[model samples]
Target chain A: MIEVNYKHKLNNFLLDISFTMPDKGITVLFGPSGSGKTSVLNLMSGLGNDKNKKINSRFIINDRVIDDSINRIKIQPWFRNIAYVFQDHRLFPHMTTKQNILFGYNRCNSELRPEVLIEKFKIKELLEHYPEQLSGGQKQRVSMVRALLSQPELLILDEPLASLDYTSRQELLPYIECIHKELDIPIIYVSHDIKEVLRLADYILIMDKGKIVDQGDIADLCISQPLLTQQEGASFILEARVTKIIEEDKLVQLDCGETILITAESMRLNDKIRVLIHARDVSLCLSPPQDSSILNCVPICVDEIQADENGKLRVIAKIGKQTIVSLISHRSARQLNIKKGKQMYAQFKATAMIK
Target chain B: MIELSPILVTLKLATITTLILLLIGTPLAWWLSNTSSKSKVVIESIVALPLVLPPTVLGFYLLLALSPDGFIGHFWLYISNTPLSFSFSGLVIGSVLYSMPFVVQPLQASFEMVGKPLQQAANTLGANSFDTFKNIVLPLSKRGFLVAITLGFAHTVGEFGVVLMIGGNIPEVTQVLSIIIYDHVEVLEYTQAHYYSIGLLVFSFIVLFVTYSFNRKLMVRL
Candidate 1:
């Protein structure tokens, strides 16, 4: 477990934040630019050392005190064993790719095998090349490997893919996901991109104006923080696994405990994924629809009915353990007599996003 | 033809001065590049004073400081039983201070050019400050080192005013190439003066050319 508490006056705002993360998972620090997201990362990693700026911080990772302002027990970044991947891939310009990766591996006395990461990140052929010779995405990959080989107790990635093009971001996402899957190293990924949060976050911390406004499981935060939706309104996420692939129809079937189908590509059998569903796309029916153009009509029970600020109504419903939301008119809510514990079916097209 | 001892003495003084300057200048330049303290400007101004100050003015103060009765000279005389003024050692001290900016400025600029990002990256990868400096900062600043060395060495070799003021023109000791050429011209020996003058001009050019060409070929990062 890693616990962080920081209070420092930045040029724009007062950065007061306190948060704890699990022993191992991707804990995202999501916020807009200048919201002190990077500042928090800097404090935790011992990178925010400006003698002019006063900071009172305490960071404890697994019962070990990494820093404490009151005690004056400040550790330097090198000895702290916290690795950071910057937005720009900060590979040493003078070193070859092999030397860059081995730099940390050698200095940290890391027991992790370098050959495995080099092969996994697919930089074997690029070993002899300098950072200038590689493409943007390739440089980032090498940087990730370099950070991982250091065997950090915590890995902080400050928008590692922000500088890449759309295709390069897509290409690099899996490599990041691979790190989460293969290693038990606790990672704090910072980003303002909604898609990245939905795809990569295991837990979410929504920061606003240097404060964590909301935080919880990604599925819960998705429904609560409208910013996580990437759309204009309320949204929810459905945890599902790939069950079947219909190549001829360009469709994929998912087992979200209800076997939902959506169109996507490049998925394997039994691969876990999250399906992002917008409340506006769903229309609630009192009973399962028999004749409709919609393919998904999952049965759900109304969890809550609240009036939206737009004079419409929002019906929060539960499908087994997972929750889905619906946006409908107040007139429709009255006609259906929508109330808590009311059984219904949600009808939405299969055009929902698959992550 | 030009009295070999003066040429030999000049090369020896320049070589020794440059080596000492590098050893002293690297840390000074590194501190100047990385520091954000209030004294940085003050220290920078002091280091740069020699660049604009007349060499004779610097030589004048150096002559006092190196004299047997002066503070630095008093302490040195008590320890080594030797006077700093009119000796090869005194000339070295003058040349080093005179050429301070040539070595330190280029090194500081190169170190600044390497930037803090790379050093931070090295730190996160478990490198202490000195380790990162040795492996990352030094290699990237190859051109800076080359320029500094060439300028330091050449500037020391061409020194005339400070050496003349402090050296007292002792043969086979402090009478360097520039002083020997001055001696020749003073005695109306224009031919001997021209020989040493042309040799110096060609030597300085060759040194600069080789250093720059090598610097370009080395693929320095900054």
Candidate 2:
């Protein structure tokens, strides 16, 4: 685990935070712009600390005390073993792809083989080309290899995909996924994009105005985070495993406590995935609705009923142990007489999948 | 027939001056580019003084400083038992001072262009300051070095007023290309003057032309 306690004065606010993040999987720093997210990263990585002084901080990564004001121990950035991949892809313009990737490897004398990384990142053909010669996605992939070759104790990705177009970003997601799956290095990824957070984040830290207001596992916290995006309604993530594939309908059957079949033909059997279901899209019925257009209808026990600001009723229910919320009207609630512990069927169609 | 000694002396002086300026200017320009100190502006203005001040004006003060009784000359005399005024060494010191901005400004601008992002990137990649400078910065700033060397060498080669004040017109010791051309003109040797003058012009044009062409190609490659 990485333990961080930092107190620094910013332009408009005093940033005081102390938190611990899991040492494995992708822990995302999610926040709006100007929320001191990058500042937190800079403090952890010891970047821009020469100018950003008067910082009272303590950081211990996996029991290694990287910095401590009380003990007066501070490691310089080079020796800190914390590598960073920037948003702009800070590749050396004078060097070719091979030279850029080997720059850190040669200095650190890392045991990680360079050829394996070159093959894994799929840049063997472009190894001789300069950074300017590569496209945006290719450049980011090369930079990722460059950082990983350093064999850092921790890796900080400050919105690496923020600069790419939709297509390029889509292309680069798998490479990032490969890093966490294939390597043991803990990553601290900073981003404000909800799609990426939903897709990649195993743990989430929500920030606002220089404070970590909330944090938890993405699946557990995904339901309560109405702040994910203002444009989209509330959504929840369900952890499921694909059980079967129905190619005739281009669907994959999932086991998320109950059976769910989503229209994702690419998913293979036994593949674990997260199904994003918006609360508004979900509707509750007194009994399991038959002969309906909705593909999903699951029996859930009503756990609670609460009135929302929009004069609508938010019906909370559970399918086995997993929770799912449905936004229903007060009239529908009065008609169905839904209440706590009442059994009902929840229906949602066309759910998004993160595989 | 043209004498070879003057050409040889000029070449030596320009070559030596360019080397010294680079050694001194690289760090100074780097410091200038990266520092936010209050003295940065003061040092910048001092370096740029040669660009605005009359060469004769600077040379008059330099001549005093290089004299045996003056500050630098007294120290040199005490240390080496040789006078600096009207000597080859004095010419170099004067040329370095006169060509300060020509070398420093380009180096400074290019170093600034390389910027802090790459340096920070290098630091995180396990390279210390010197390693980052040698491996990451120096190679990236090659164009700046080229511009700096070209301007420094060409400016020192073409120096006349400061060379006149501090170096005088001693044959084989202190006489450079510009001073020899002036000497030929002074004696009303119009033929010799044209030969040397045209030589200096063509030499300068060719040097600048070759450098700019090379610079353009580098730009395209990048």
Candidate 3:
């Protein structure tokens, strides 16, 4: 676990935040601007050194005390074994891409092979070129390779995609996924984009006005704080395993609570996936609808019903042991008499967000 | 006939002064660019004093300091047992002080332009401050070094009042191009003065032209 508690006085606000992150997954720091997200990363990486700013903090990573105000033990950033990929991709302008990637590798005497990262990031052809010659997506890819070649215990990415256009961002997302899937190093990714957060985060820390408002596993946080996701629709994720594939119809069978059909492509049987079901896409019925053309209509028990600010009722129900939410109109809830402990059938079509 | 000794002496003095300024000015400029202490302003003003103050006024104080009984002269005499007044060594000391700002300002501006982002990036990438400065900051400041060297050399070559007040026009030792030109005009030998004046003019123009052209090429790659 990586634990941190930090307090700093900014010009307009005081930033006081504390949290512990899992050791080996992407824990995203999500917030709007001026939320002190970058400051947290700086403090952990030991780059928050300014003469006027007095930061009182304690940061420990896996039993190693990186910073402790009480003990007066603050390691320099170079010695902290942390790699940071900044928003601007601050590549050395004087060095070619090859030398830039090898900078940290040569400095730390790292045992990781540079060629492995070079090939993984697909920067072989761009090695001889300088940073100015590469495109934005290509530069970010090189920056990631540069960070990974150091073999850091933790990696920090500060909105590495914020500067890129839509096409570049789409191109770079899979490379970021590879960082977590192919490599075991823990990563602290900072982003305000909801789509990036939902796709990349295994855990989430929500910040507002320099404070951590809430944090938990991504699935729980999405339901608990819908506003934090900032996505247009309320969505909940379901962890399921693919049981079969009907190739003729381009549909995959997932076993979440029961056999469910989702429109997905290139999915193999036995592959685990997370299906994002938007609350608006689901509807309720007193009995299973026959010949309705809805692919999924699973029996569920209403656990609770809560009124939302939009004059709609968010019906929380259990399909077997798994939780699903449906946002339905209040008039419909009154007409159907949906209440706590009510038994009904929830129907929806699953959209595969990630395979 | 034109004596070549003054030209040679002037070249030698300018060469040595430029070399020494680079060695000392680089670190001083680096510190000035990066430091936030209040004392930085005081040091910066002192380095810049030569830019505004008349050269004769600066030469007069340097003349006092280089005399046998003056503080710096006494220290120098203690080490080498030679009075610094009117010596080639004294002229060198005078020229260094006169040309300090020219060398340091360009370097400081260059260092500032490189900024803190790249250096922080280097630190996080496991490079210490010294390594980052050497590998990153130094190479990126190539244009600054070029400007500093060119301006420092040219300013030292054109120095007249400081060299005259300190070196006293001694032949083959302290005489320089500017002093020789002054002596020829004092004697109403306008033809002799023209030879040196036009040569200095062409040299200065050529140096500036080459530096700016070369800098433009370097900028494209950067």
Error of 1 at A74 (Å): 1.6
Question: Over the stretch A1-355, how does candidate 2's per-residue lDDT look in tens digits?
Answer: 8999988898799888888999989999998999999889888877764463677889999999998988988888899999999999999999999999998898896999998888888999999999999999999999999999999889999999999999999899989998988899899999988878888899999988888888898987776665662325666778898899999999889899999878886777898888878778899998887789889999999998877667777787898789888888989999999989998899886454555
**Candidate 1, DockQ score (0 to 1):** 0.78
lDDT of 3: 0.89
How accurately is candidate 3 docked according to DockQ?
A: 0.79
Candidate 1 — which residues are off by over 4 angstroms?
Answer: A226-235, A245-247, A266-269, A278-294, A299-315, A326-345, A349-355, B210-222
The residue-by-residue lDDT of candidate 3 on A1-355, one tens digit each, is 9999999887789999999999999999998888899888888888775457787889999999998988988899999999999999999999999999999998887888888888888999999999999999999999999888888999999999999999999999889988988899999999988778777899999999989999999888877785653356768888899999999999999999877999999887798888888888899999998889988999999998887877788898888778888989989999999989999999998876553
Model 2 residue pairs with clashes: none
The lDDT ranking, best first, is 3, 1, 2
- For model 2, report the TM-score of its A chain: 0.92
Provide i-RMS per model in Å.
Answer: 0.7, 0.7, 0.6
Docking class of 1: medium
Query: Which pairs, if any, clash in model 3?
Result: none
Give the C-alpha miss distance for residue A15 in model 3, angstroms.
Answer: 2.2
User: How far is B75's C-alpha from truth in model 2 (Å)?
Assistant: 0.4
Measured against the native two-chain assembly using Cα atoms, what DockQ does each of the candidate structures obtain, in the order listed? 0.78, 0.80, 0.79
Query: Where is the poorest 10-residue window by lDDT in model 2 chain A?
Result: A223-232
Candidate closest to the true structure, highest lDDT: 3
Docking class of 2: high
Estimated TM-score per prediction? 0.91, 0.93, 0.93
